[model samples]
Target: MKNSSFIRKDIFGVPVLKSEILESFKDLSHGFSTRRGGESPAPYDSLNIGIAVGDLEENVKKNRNLISGISCSERSVYLTQVHGSEILVIKNDSSIPDPDTVKADGVITDCKDLALVIQTADCQAALLYDPVKKVAGAVHSGWRGNVFDILGRTVRKMAEVFDSDPSDIRASIGPSLGPCCAEFINFRTELPEALWAYGDEKCFFDFWEISRAQLQKAGLQADRISVSGLCTKCDKDSFFSYRGSKITGRMAGFICINN
Candidate 1:
């Protein structure tokens, strides 16, 4: 897959979504936001998207609305990422009513007018779309989830649930902590044995490569997948990096079926 760089500013004064790849989806409103435009205070600074991180509820709600205005539905389904392999199939009614409701790593939905949302700081946030089926999915793939091959599983689930063909699916790997900053102390124990079992004994792990590999393993066409090779830790001004700040805000990676 080839990576193209793009940037867009939201009406709310924050950098929301990338521009170069937006041309591919004419029927969807999607964006991967930065921590720049919001009403929250320090720690959460401005555009903090996570509600459970102690940011005021009102502020979080407002932030959500601002981002949603760009490319989401009136009702959006947000996942409670637990760093696991559980992928839930969401319907129109399965939204996150409160911040502490349900927990899952990935979500897939075929219902129109219902957007799929995922939150992340340093973890990988992937958006999958089947233009032929008009179905979209959002996945939060952390190191733990990657070890379990959550992306590959999510692709398979999308195929089973929406009758989507991997060849017809277009995906984007949003900003995440890259190998330059993602250093593991104990490579053998920190990562899955299976990763090392395949002879990846390097000091640092490249999540972008791992994710791209997983997408191909799921039978997705190489040209259909795109990655935003921006490293969260490397670009702190435009994104929030968990490794950069132990206590920091989250960015929203959103995808929706246009009404």
Candidate 2:
């Protein structure tokens, strides 16, 4: 499967969805949204997918609809994204509740025609799919979530829920603040011990590396995984970055079924 790219513009004339990886999975619809599309104004600019970010509810709804159109899902399921390691199993009924009502960094679902969504600015957004089992999962992995191996946990949850095998799983690591731009302070405490446990001080803390390592540990083949090396903080025009702009809007990473 060769990697390709595509851009989907929001109704408001913003390039809301863009994908650099996972282009091979044309049967499945997925994209990473930008902040250029929507109805929000000022602080939120136009497209702010985050409802709790002080953006108006109506604008958030519109932005969501735009995303849903690109993903080809009726509606996208949002996660509370507490930066924790919690992984939740999602069913058809699971989409009814608001994101605030649920707490999880990752969610997995086998239900057809449902979209799995995750919000991120500087944090890593991971999308996983097992074509064989027809299972999908979305993960929001911030530094805290990475420390606890949330990606692996999510894959394990998928295995339990859909009897998915990691080897059959295809994964895409969406844009985020790359290691070159993702610096940390007070690393002694802010970061977990497992990071230093491997004795790679020169390596610093690369979320991409951590994510890839975790995915491999979960059994996904090296060829099945793709990483978007784009750094949100570095590419101001293409993505929204919390570290690049503290009060910036959030970008969404979504995966869904065409049915």
Candidate 3:
């Protein structure tokens, strides 16, 4: 959701999704990518960033180059994204492959030399930063992730690995399927009853609110959390929604600290 509501910018040509909440952090390079400004053909139409989603690998490489360039990255780390809670921690001395073969849904780093990337079509990409500890984390969270408390776990991982206190952490929930179109036909078996309260008569779930709740449980202040509030399904022109197109491109949510 790189609309006006988000900290929108045209980087060379791509519409980048940024968080105004994290904008004040002068030493961080973090933003989400929209569906525009790429070389991939229709279905992926312009800004498809995912390498395994049927798009031309060469085209994805070009888009990836643009993304890394925006952050002025020396190295970029991408996750395999299994929709699970596993997280990868990157140290300053870590040597990652070019295409990023790590298999995890969340990534955390205290090093400023590498940028962490998470690709998403409709799932929420939750970016976290602890200014006090100078640490950053990025999560690939969807309904399945929520069911396992992935956001909270990522926060805890930051604390365990980076010595970060959740109370001092600031969060940004990026564009994904909003409550308006987050319908789950078998939510009763998919989600807990407590979360069922967020469902509408039509079965739409308030994932943003759910993210907020998860943040609270992890100890972040309510005011410290920022929500993009942009629905990818509705804003199909600027975003990629898996449910909207079934075979659409993925938006990139990237975060990195500055040296």
Candidate 4:
């Protein structure tokens, strides 16, 4: 029901956030990375997992490798996230290309040991796992994605592709721009009318609740979804925050089925 559902843990000197909601499933490997423990320098600081953010490609690769190693995934699929609702579904692990090749804001997969990575500086990464169908998905639901209902679309995609029931899906929203720091001055022009209700008079919006409501609307149970509620802008030292620092690195959210 709150961020208390997630815990911070150290993995090979790197700090990551793990949710208790998905911990009961031994066949699943999932975590949200902090901005610590990597090869990038300065603005990226250390654990910046996004290669398109001006960081050196070698540094990003090494950082991603560290994430893959700690996550126990064979390969981590990074995407060219454009903040849209396009969700890519992976059914095969063979012939996988290098990172940041795919163009999608979300990814669903039945392939084991292949981690779906959603890199974010302040956006929300919703991780989904349908243990019943052995399916896993990751969605980068930024403000634009919320307007498009990316998570809901991903859920329906899973149902269509993997025959996964939303009831059987367990979802988690990782650390992101919380309501406290998510101030949008032009909500009327930027956000949809329905989404306007989630904002305050001062313009700050509660995206966590927005994502939770979207998941429930997509047929997922409220109890099965966990929100980290950790604000990236507030905790800029731990996670990257573009709003806090425009020239910042991207932390990632990873999910995979154990081989």
Which numbered prediction scores highest in lDDT against the true structure?
4
What's the best-to-worst order under TM-score?
4, 3, 1, 2
Tens digit of lDDT per residue, candidate 1, span 118-156? 899999999988888877888999888789899999999
What's the TM-score of every candidate structure? 0.90, 0.88, 0.95, 0.96
Best by TM-score: 4
Q: State the displacement of the C-alpha of residue 214, model 4, in Å, after optimal TM-score superposition.
A: 0.5
Distance from true location, Cα of 131 in model 4, Å: 0.6
Q: Give all candidates' CA lDDT scores.
A: 0.80, 0.78, 0.87, 0.90
Cα misplacement distance, residue 254 of candidate 1 (Å): 0.2
Per-residue alpha-carbon lDDT of candidate 4 for residues 144-230, written as tens digits (9 for 90 to 100): 999999999999999999999999999998999999999999999999899999999999999999999999999999999999988
Residues 83-152, model 2: lDDT tens digits: 9988878765654567678898898887777888899998989988888877889999988887888989
CA RMSD of all predictions:
2.8, 3.3, 1.7, 1.8
lDDT of 3: 0.87
Query: What local lDDT does model 2 show for residue 13?
Result: 61
87: Cα error in model 1, Å: 1.2
Write the number of the candidate with greater TM-score, choosing between 2 and 4.
4
Query: After superposing candidate 4, which stretches have Cα over 4 Å from the reference?
Result: 93-101
Error of 1 at 227 (Å): 1.1
